[model samples]
Target: MTLLAFLLGLALGIGFWLWQRQRLQRQLKQMLGVLQTDASSTAMSVVSRLRQEIAQANEHRSQLEERLQTWRRLLEVAPLGYLQVDEENRLLCCNDQARHLLQIDRWEPRQLRLLLELVRSYELDQLIEQTRHQQKPTIQEWVFHPPCLDGEAMGEVRSLTLRASSWPLPHGHVGVFLENRQPLIELAQSRNQWFSDLAHELRTPLTSIRLVAEALQGRLENPARRWVEQLLHETNRLINLIQNWLELSNLEKNPSKSLTYQSLELRSLIQSAWQTLEPLAQQKQMCLAYVGPDTLWIRADEARLTQVFLNLFDNSIKHSHRQGTIRVEVTAREAQVLDSEGTVDSPPFSNASDQPDSDASPSLIQIDMIDTGSGFADSDLPHVFKRLYRGDPSRQKSQGTSEPFTLVGSSGSGLGLSIIQQIIQAHGGTVQARNHPETGGAWLQIKLPDHKNLS
Candidate 1:
């Protein structure tokens, strides 16, 4: 019986060991399944994140493309000519206006062609080169003669005056803007021609009228004689007006023409000009204070320069209060000196003469004429030098009292300053008008190159 019990116990122990092994296998399978599920979830999360990034990248690229297209459209329709060039001076892009201005044939938008080959403009190329090298904006103006095609007349050169401004861009590129100034210039020339023709037509009629007035002046008496004298005065004023118009037309037509330049004393010229208007000055008891060298010299056309001073003096005398002083000051200095009151580099009516001949001189003569009169009306300063620009009638009437005795030349023709400015410009000089800061009077300043300084 003891032997049987031992065998049964051993069998029970083996059964227990088999049951534990089955339980451990079940636990291992459960752990493996859990690990596999976690790995799958991690992989799906990574894939989702990568897809979102790709989509965002595509959207950003699309936005960039849209912006680029918008810019292209705007540039294509711009009125001003626009051109873009690459580092190699190859034409990268241009607007229709640019193509028309350059007279270039149509080409593919992306095509790379040398700019010189298409336009053949040295000035444009030089402007671009300058901008690239200096990395700064540059402006240039030149008259371009378009290349003649076959069957075109050799003399039929199409000339265009163009102004171009260029600036550097990223990647060694340059951008240029072009403007055609031919139309505006032609319009100005047309207006000038019309005026000149009108002036010519009026001259003969004016001369005949003046002769008639003179004849009538002698054959009248008493109040009628006074009327005849007034008529003569009005007629003579008209004649002078016509003469001045013709003279101005001639000057505008060719500023440098018929110039007879000579060295003469400026102070003496001023005194001489003053002498012609002495009777008018004396009528008002106006004091003339000439504060300049008695023998300052300038190279100029004596007659024209005398007219300049006469006009200025007359203007001052007409505007000065009775017993008020008109002071004339003259000084010589280097070209670099800046006139604190006014610089004659730019005048009110028109562009001044080009800088005096580079080889000529480096000295400038400055003249200041100040009148202790009602200063230029603040509103009238800009228009003072424009042809036929009259000041306020009230102001003119008030100033008219200064020279009550001289009736004929008392009032301004409104052409005095304009003519004076032109005469000074013809001498390679400039003139400016302003109110004296200290004196509260009319101030006129002139600058002329000193010929004695020439090397």
Candidate 2:
């Protein structure tokens, strides 16, 4: 019985040990399975996030590439020169047009800055200064002798007008645009040449007529008087035409060119012009009167300004009927009034210091041509300065009344007022034609800057 009890106790101990070992094995298997599942889930999440990021990055790259290509195409195809420069004016990039125009190849940033060093013209230097200092776009032109005929023949000088526009960009970049203007320069040069040639042609005929008229003087008897007079009249008409041609030529050459200014009293000039036209006025039985102050002064080219006033006076006399009164008045006016009238009052005649203040002082000289003859049509006022324009052609064709002067055809070349207008404009003055409200006749007015501001 004691041996049986000891064996049973040993068996029990063995059974308990086996059961504890089994429980530990099962728990180990379950913990290993849970760790494997957690690792797989974490790896899958990482892979999914990386794939999405890669796809988004590819899409962004495609968009950027498309925009870059579009800009490249535009730079290549633009007609005018397109250039990019650094703040130091070194070339950064250039389009095809810029490369062709500037003769640039394998562009280096240093090349453009060096190109400017070769420019000797002062105009180009000024333009560059204006662009840099003013920070504004500027236009300039230069004449260059380019190689011609496929680089075989010597090229004639051709003008190239360049308009450069600069803009500030990111990274201190500057953009410049250039265009060619050779054609316009050529056209202007051609016009000047033509005007020069025409002046010479018209001069010869005038010289001949004046010489012949002087030779025929006092050689005609009473029986030949009419024919001689007609010849003389025609010669004078031709002379007037030639003079007009010369005046037009000068105007085209330099619209503002005039003689050195001189100081003179306005009343004196008007009195002289009036005396010169006195014979013509008297022949028409017209009274030529000056109704202005005697102390008025102006600064001007005496001869040119005299011619302007004289022309208007002569027109008045020629158009006025016999015994008509021609009135001349000088006064002051406001700036607003003259501007509204589309004209400027004639400047006081004197030196630059003696002229009237157009803003503050109301000093203006007005010469009125009032006539008793038939007035001009209002419709014809605007065109009175046009060449060969005639008012009352039928009446003019019938010749003058009482004075027996020829009124139409060649006596007035229709360029008198036109010449007057051009001369007045050159003097920084203005002229206007209107029918008189009181006398119901044609009135010609001249307005100029005050003498004090002549310079």
Candidate 3:
């Protein structure tokens, strides 16, 4: 009986062990399957993300390329010559106009090359350097002489006067614009020549008519005598106009020929100019008042400056109220000139002998001539100095209240102020016309540089 129970127990134990081993193997196989599935899902997710990233990168690159193409197309059609340089003055891009203007043929856009190697212009290089240093827009004009082709001197050297404007850009880059001004200059020269020729042709006929009118004035009486006198006056006025035209033409043709500069006192010159027009001023009961140093000396052409003052005084006297006053003020001081390409005249100090050393400083002489008369019309102010410009009826009258001064010699040729401006500009001076704030009259201001400081 004991042996039978032991055998049954051993059998049961073996059966139980076999069942546990089978269960363990099944669990291991199930876990391994789950691990394989998770690994496959993670790898697919990574591949999808990489594809999306590549597509986005391609889209961004396409947009950038499109923008670059658009810019290039726009530049191709631009009329003005356009040029771009990198930080080191390397030519990065240029348009057709630029290539033609610079006479460059062996360059392509986007190819990096030194600007100096292609275009041999010192002025252009200097302009670029200046613009970069100042970080401001700069304008410069220079003549370009093309070199001979094929290293031979057989070709004609064409000279082009070019005006260039440059400005700074990002990353130390620069942009330049070019203009050709030779056409306008030539047109102006041709027009001046025609006008000078016409003025010369009219001189003899005008003189002959003046003589005939003078002869008829002695043979007429009363109303007829008055008519002859009027005709004589008109003829004489025409003759004066012709003479003035000729004189102005000569001055414009050769400014240096008309100028004979000398040191003269400002006060004395004013006094002398006023004397020439005293007869007209007295006729209108006008007075002259000067407020300045007793003597201010400046280097100037005495005769031309006297003419300037005389014209100004006459205009003032004609427009002055009867018994009204015209005031002249002169002042001098130092000022920083923004543009130093021109010369100027300066006033003298209080002491007659105290002359300024122009080499030591830049000085300006300001002359303000104000009148108590009808001010310039707003519409007429800009054209006051233009040749042959006559104002409208409202501007022609005195403050819209009375007739213009019609004295025999009072009617001007409408060229006086134009001539004044020309003379002053030739002397390296500037003139401005405005209505005085306090006096409510025409204000003419003249600014001249000190001659000693002129280069």
* lDDT for each residue of candidate 3 in 368-387, tens digit (9 for 90 to 100): 88887776767778788876
The C-alpha stretches of model 3 lying farther than 4 A from their native spots are 1-67, 102-161, 222-230, 283-285, 320-324, 333-364, 393-411, 452-455
Task: Identify the runs in model 2 with alpha carbons over 4 angstroms from their true place.
Answer: 1-196, 209-229, 334-369, 395-411
Candidate 2 Cα lDDT to native:
0.64
Score residue 422 of candidate 1 by CA lDDT: 83
* Candidate 3 clashing pairs, residues 3+ apart or interchain: 344-449, 345-448, 345-449
Candidate models: Cα lDDT each: 0.77, 0.64, 0.78
Encode model 2's per-residue lDDT on 1-455: one tens digit a residue: 79999999989999999999999999999999999999999999999999999999999999999999899789889888877765565666777887666555555544556334332345434444456666656565655333343644345434466555555565555566767666666686687567557757766876787677667767877757667777778778777776665675576568766455777687789889888888877887888666555476667778887887677677677766767877765554555657544455443222334434534544344544455445565556666776556665544322344221222222377667777777777766667777666766666667766666656
Candidate 1 TM-score to native: 0.70
Instruction: List model 1 lDDT by residue over 1-455, tens digit each.
Output: 78888989888999999999999999999999999999999999999999999999999999999999998898889888999999999999999988988888856689999998898888898899989999999989999877877665868667889999998999999999999988987897888788778878887887887788788878877888788788778877776777776787778778888467777877788889999998989988987886644456677789998888877788788877888888887665545654653353432222223223333344777788888776777767778778877776455423444422111222356677788788888777888888776666788888887756322
> 2 or 3: which has the higher lDDT?
3
Considering TM-score, which of the candidate structures 1 and 3 is the better prediction for this target? Answer: 3
| Model 1 worst lDDT run, 10 consecutive residues | 402-411
Off by over 4 Å in 1: 1-64, 84-92, 102-154, 163-175, 221-230, 290-294, 335-362, 393-411, 451-455
